[model samples]
Target: MPDRSLNADTVPAAGPHDVPKAQQAVEERLIDTVLQSFADCEDPRLGQVMQALVRHLHAFVREVRLTEEEWDKAIEFLTEVGHITDDRRQEFILLSDVLGASMQTINVNNEACGDATEATVFGPFFVDDAPRIEQGGDISGGAVGQPCWVEGTVRDTEGSPVPNARIEVWEADEDGFYDLQYTDDRVSGRAHLFSDDEGGFRFWGLTPTPYPIPHDGPVGRMLAATGRSPMRASHLHFMVTAPQLRTLVTHIFVRGDELLESDTVFGVKDSLIKDFVQQPADAPTPDGRELGDRTWARARFDIVLAPA
Candidate 1:
């Protein structure tokens, strides 16, 4: 009860010349009222968060003078986003990604430490229980794309080998579709493997290629309205995890990809871009697997993880 009532001096003078100021005082009172409701919240953190959220939301509404019609439209759009979200599709994540919210959260959480590999947005396509592959084995699993040899070592920031680290890798095919996008139960273009005793691992995957995110839903409409493209840069996804180390969800972009500068998710990092060297169709394969006449590519990505 510390003077919850507004002081006359704190409010604008009641006169014809103070219409805007009076309205602002009223709005501020509303914000205070909403904030007070959370005062008795048992959790201090929740109360603090709720109060901040209320303040910001009210400030936004006041700054924009948001119209009822616009608010209604936003509600409608979010409803559509919820309706379209299901097992295979996540329109909410797509919305967050396109707005750079995902990358912003990553940036806030991932601090620069030593030469540790930077983190990026984890696209919604990752699935649990992916097929496992042996070292130097093929993860493509018959996906349609040029073969790519992906080799890498997992090391700590001190450059110590992290043996038996779990690495999950996945990517879309040449046609710009993940295996889950197909109507059938086909599992390809994704797999997991553990680092060797020496922290080395290699596998065959499809060459990274640029692809538009899933964009036939409400999120797509939003993008179209804003004059933005949904294309992500050519890249491959990796999630590396080891004991007592920070788990990393990142991607390696192909150097010189046109979409790198404007990736829809804003997930590209200069440190993550690597060269994918193309080889002749008759070039020898790393594991000596015969690839009739199709050319292949190779890339090496050495990862350094930060302490947990």
Candidate 2:
């Protein structure tokens, strides 16, 4: 049986000798009062979670000696974030992404799966029911960016093909804007497709380019105030799913992007970086498709999925 006690480990340590004993006792009692308030929480997991949250939050407040005025400002800032969030934009997710919480959650939940691909942040722009495209079809939908050919094989950890696997992809254009960033509803640079029996898939997309996270929002203002840049590295977002296999939400980054080392969302992993080679107009494509008077880029991303 698990230990149900909230022992010494659950509470913060005593203050230094220079600090007033009365103040420390007051803080400790305040934490105890808060914890007791939720002691009767019906769900054990919810009780544990709430207890931990209160303990950590109170410790943080004491550590920073947080002022009432600052707390009010934080409440106001979060209120503004909620006000700006909608179907097209998710400011809270943007806030979490910038704070590294999103990446940290991904790390904790996704463990090593043999040769299976690594996972990263899902960002704030994934759309459902994306238009399905056929093999070698263009997904850019006339969005502005240099032409790029993306080909990949989806496989299981055992190296067998994952036939009929669903792969959804989305990215920003050369101007660093996702389709939702426009005033009107326009679907660009987004699509979903299935892998063939051989686990092969292909599509035309824009070369991944570095783009700033929507910086006009509250999250962006927070980044600017903290002297941080809102730039995410050049990359393509991918969500892959197959029967009996874990759904993977990740990104493939351009190997030489300047922002790779300093992505605001901290979503980059060494394994997810790949070389996006530029191909001349005369280069032969994998499907023997001909490019006339047009230079393009090519990248192959083989994905391996872990059993669910």
Cα lDDT listed for each candidate: 0.91, 0.91
Q: What 10-residue stretch in candidate 2 is worst by lDDT?
A: 11-20
Worst 10 residues of 1 by lDDT: 10-19
lDDT of 1 by residue, 1-308 (tens): 33434455444333222225567778779998999999999999999999999988886776667789999999999999999999988889989999899999999898999999999999889999899988997888889999999998999999999999999999999999999889898999999999998899999999999999988989998888999998999999999999999999999999999999999999999999999999998999988989999999999999999999
Task: List model 2 lDDT by residue over 232-265, tens digit each.
Answer: 9999999999999999999999998989999999
TM-score of each prediction? 0.93, 0.92
lDDT of 2 at 110: 94
Q: For model 2, name the residue pairs that clash.
A: none
